[model samples]
Target: MTTHYLTKLLRYRAWADQLTYGAVAALPEGAAEATRATIFGNMLGTLSHTYVVDDIFQAHLQGRSHGYTSRKMPEPLALNELWLRQQAMNDWYLAYAQALSPAQAAEEVSFQFIGGGDGRMSREEMILHVVNHATYHRGFVAEMFYQVPAKPPATDLPVFLRDVSQP
Candidate 1:
């Protein structure tokens, strides 16, 4: 994939994440931390999982150990703290993508999965995975919003492209 496309994807990822976090934070007190029927436990839990996974892939792209044993964090971060960490990771991803040349984007990297297996992906593929993974979990967060009987932010890619990202 082209560096231009990679940069755009990361930008889209960051935009959607910001909107998701805002929606969660806007929920009534205790709503974000309330236990839910989902696997991650609650809204915060689901978002934290995405952050952890993003961190794991960040380490993979850097060719370093992520030092994470699982996709989920042991302790869920509060909404404010989680947003800070997520913002940093999102910034790192954007910088990394913006710096990639065509050759660098296509370069293959190998890493061990948190699930215990060898894994390999091109830099472009890994970036795609990170963006896609966050989008997938944001769906979970959006679902939890319904449990709150509240409206979630419109984080759809087309919305981002039309309203946020410029041509």
Candidate 2:
């Protein structure tokens, strides 16, 4: 896809990330970190994983090491801190996508995955993967909220598109 399209997708991803974080923020204090039976352990665990992966890909696209040895931080960040980090990372993705030339977007970035596998992706593909990967884990966080017996902010792509499409 074109860099222009990539920017739009990144913007959508940022919007959804904000919505998800907002929903988590509105939960009763401590609920985000409350232990649960999910792959990432809890809402905070899942959200931290998203941030970690986003940072990893951000470093990849920039041709730098993220300095992260695992898929998540050693200690999960506090929800507010994690939200702020996620915001900055999302902003980075938006700016990075906007700055790409079509050729640069297609440039192959080779890097080592966190799990010890070699990996390569075009800048565009990396952008798409980051967006898709975050969306996937946000689903896990939403499910964690249901265990809290609260509804989450709906973050479907169509919701983002329709919400922003209107005047």
Candidate 3:
């Protein structure tokens, strides 16, 4: 994939994340923390899982240990705290993507999976995974929004492309 396309994807990811977090934060007290059928327990848990994965990938990109034994974070952060951390992570990704050269993006990185196994992917592939993974979990968060009888923000890539794309 071209760096231009990847950078746009990263920007779209950040935009979607902001909208998702905003919708969750606006929910009534206990709404975000409500028990759900999702694997991560609740909305916060689901989002936290995405954050942990992002952290893990960030370390992998840097060729260092991520210190995460599992994708699940034992203690989920409060909505505000999670948003803050996610924003920082999002910014890091944007900067990283912006700085990535064509060769760097194509270079394969090998790392140990948190679930125990060898894994490898190109740097661009890793970035794509991070963005795609978060998008997948945000669907879970959107599902939880209905439990609150609330409408989640439109976070589809098309929406981002149409409404937020920059020149």
Candidate 4:
């Protein structure tokens, strides 16, 4: 069951990343810099925050402390660079997960949080948390795209499954 869930989550993450990159690519050159939000301050900032959080969680899964200090807004990379990096990270995660056994998934792992405290969780739980975290942020990005003239790609899990099923 855990492996099945992991497979679905991996697929969802890949689909979501592709959708995000597509939306980001369609934006005007300076659109990410211009769009402001109450919490994230801007689209670029929000996306950077999402990336930073993912990095932090990835480090945690590796039993290391998070290195990022602030959610520094990444300079707009070329669409290819952005998409390639996202795809690489997602592929790495899927590979890591596929290598795990049920016993490994149930094992407790420890790592330090960004601020100061040590944290521990089962590998399975951590993987699920990472998926949930990405989903939440992707939803935010999807909302940001809704305000723009060009429609973002459909990010819903069912939509992703349906599209993948067709071909």
- The lowest-lDDT stretch of 10 consecutive residues in candidate 2 is 158-167
TM-score of 4: 0.84
lDDT of each candidate versus the true structure = 0.91, 0.88, 0.92, 0.72
Clashes of each: 0, 0, 0, 0
**Which candidate number would show the highest lDDT if scored against the true structure?**
3
lDDT tens digits, residue span 69-123, model 4: 6645345554466567667777877887888899988888887666668888888
Candidate 2 lDDT over 50-146, as tens digits, reads: 8888888989988887899899788867888998998999998889888888899999989998889899899899999999999999899888888
The C-alpha RMSD in Å for every predicted model, in order, reads 0.8, 1.4, 0.8, 2.6
TM-score, cand. 2: 0.96
Comparing 3 and 4 on TM-score, the stronger one: 3
Window of ten residues with lowest summed lDDT in model 3: 68-77
Candidates ranked, most accurate by TM-score first: 3, 1, 2, 4
Candidate 4 clash pair list: none
Give the runs in model 4 whose Cα sits over 4 Å from its true position: 71-80, 165-167
Choose 2 or 3, whichever is better by lDDT: 3
TM-score of each: 0.97, 0.96, 0.98, 0.84
lDDT of 3 by residue, 76-146 (tens): 78889989999999999889988999999999999999878999999999999999999999999998898
- The reply for model 3, stretches above 4 Å from the true place, is none
Residue 133 Cα positional deviation in candidate 3, in Å, after optimal superposition: 0.3
